[model samples]
Target: MKADSEFKKVLTLFPVVLFGLAYMVPLTVFSTYGIVAQITKGLLPAAYVVTLLAMLFTAFSYGRMVRAFPYAGSAYTYTQKSLGSYAGFFAGWVLLLDYLFLPMINYLLIGIYLNAEFSAVPVWVWILLAVTLVTFINIRGIKLVANVNFLLILFQVLFVVMFIILSIKALVSDGSVQSLFSITPFFSEDSSLSLVFSGAAILCLSFLGFDAVTTVSEETIDAKKTIPRAIFLVTMIGGGLFILVAYLGQLIYPDYNAFIDPDSAGLEIAAFLGGNVFKSLFLAAYIIGCIASATSSHASVSRLLFAMGRDSVLPKKVFGYISLKYHTPVLSTLIVGIAALAALIFDLETVSSFISFGALSAFSLVHLSVIAHFYIRGRKRSLSETIVYLITPLIGLTLCVWLWTSLSSSSFILGISWIVIGTLYLAYLTKMFKDKPPELTFDADEDIKVSS
Candidate 1:
């Protein structure tokens, strides 16, 4: 493997945070609003609040880990350094599943939205167009993806702000303005703890992108400080967007039963709030948001594979190759793009569950890594440090387990099957635990090393 190729440190706080936001795709709040509200029985805001706080704990854990590792592998690097090679490999493998399917979910959403607008065009056409465009942007470089993501995220924010204002106006004109500030969106008589946590499990998907910031740590200047801040800010900002949109969206149509189809319910509300013209703008913004998300997803997943390949966990010649001129992982980018074509065969429900399961699994292990690294292995700590390192992560772990239980049975079966396959592959790689896996040094200079 060559050590000449490396990721340029062009990302500062803002661009890195923008990448996270784009990956999260704030407009997703509206895209899946009806189903979450249906699950929470009108208390969508409460669900987001729970999921946000839960994710924040995990976010803190990630921040701490990045300061120590500051590498491109995200949870894979953290868990490996904190726990062991085997644990890290599985962590990376699970996240690989998440990264692999995330582009599919984004393209699927684009296809679904486009299909709704132009019945003459098949959804597959829109999916292919989305994959092609995002792949091009990703292969160019992270800087381009960051620039594109910032603009698209701004457009998405404008659309959401416009939708909120229009919803308020529609309510005022109809003499029901009180719904805009009602507490029912946060908590209602029908809302229960079980239901809220269940909804949180679903909404956790919205927070998936924050951890991705850590994957770009090597490409970030002052990664130890910048990556942590980006992680925290992205989670908070994305959470705020989800809560605000869900709140206003609920105010517009407080009754989920009013939706003709819960899947496209947000479109119905868009039409009612601002007529067809505004609805068209809303659709355009959403499509752009999906493209931004797919672009970010591809960029991050390529980095992850590059990290793994650089470490000799996979084929170094292919997955680890980086374009010296572009400073991008060309082969890995194309691999993700090609794998996303599988999206055409699956439905939205299956992909959503797969993404959620893989993401939550990775998140749970990340929290555990914090405990493993700090409390169990690191030096003695003060009371405050103890709470930060141990107690908070334990709480985060419990919440993750609770959320994991909320996943569908199919998700559990499929997720476990993937894990089993990963274990089998690892056994082959290590010769049934008789040898140590390879490890690599990741830095801006692109140093490559192998440890037996």
Candidate 2:
């Protein structure tokens, strides 16, 4: 019940930070370049400067919420605690899309990357191989998952550190100092500011691993302390690293588009700097990073489904079952696996923006929840907490609205439709399971009645 106790557990910040580095690296490089044309009108550095500031605003709200709740469910947990069940369900549902499809996206990228390494092998084979291995590892349990993540993150962070150092060296030796600020005018003479910011806002989607860690809160030891610390460290350090990489990208290749080919952005950057060896290294790191992202994402979807089943808001028999042997959520992980693979087959550009929309939607609610819980409820959070909770969330919400609007009206309709479907399902299940709430007295030895 105490706020201070949540911040007590020991975490070195490195392991806390390790899980997110995988998701952040590739996401930053690929997603950022997609928006560069709009922001810099082909100039890269100017666009990134704008992006760094926008990311900071959203991250502030995320950091505060993690400290506040420090529970499982990430956005799902926070929204339910503050706003009530229905709102929480929508938050969880939208986020399910983000988590469900991520492995597919990672697989798709990995498949493509591996195709170059072993040209004869099909990408799907590699995808199947990667997912098979990861699922088995995840099935082992959160502790093993964490260990896998710790190692993946270690490799990824080392790669990135080497990258930054190499990039700085290459840029300094090969290019002019003045080029750093050469593309200062981000909002080109001809471009619309609204559109440019929108693109940049869209680019911040890659900087979204902060709250992703929150979804793993249940499996975390001393979650109240560990979760918040993880959130802050990942966002602040990772966000800064992303910006540094982006800027280094600009420094290494003032004309970034030319340096990074449309098909292989990270590869081209590596090629532009140090040729095949460096490029190959970057690709290897990028793939490892994507796997890290998938690992965290896999854990998130499993936990979300587990929570829903516990609430009796989902099919208790289908989603409720945890792997007895591994003590991990079993059915939920299977469903997520199927969904992520399916997402790859029908993969749409709209999915990425929608991912951002869902993430920010939940993020907005979490920030609002902080205000509702700690401030409006007259709980223990200080004025500083109150201000951060209120102001930061509002800023993040407004940013969400801006980016949400930027999506084609079709994405808006799809986004809205998904929530509506989730609501109806939630209501149906709520009514069906109305009287079936899990009882404290219900013995594990007794009949485990599961409502369909």
lDDT of each: 0.86, 0.64
The TM-score obtained by model 2 is 0.84
Deviation from native of the Cα of residue 77 in model 2, angstroms: 1.5
Candidate 1 is scored at a TM of 0.95
lDDT of 1 at 148: 94
Residue-level lDDT of model 2, residues 271-303, one tens digit each, is: 767789877777777788777777767877787
lDDT of candidate 1 over 220-276, digit per residue (tens): 888889999999999999998788888888877788878888888877888888889
Clashes of each: 0, 0
Per-residue lDDT of 162 in model 2: 78
Best by TM-score: 1
User: Model 2: how large is the Cα RMSD against the reference?
Assistant: 5.7
lDDT of 1 at 172: 83
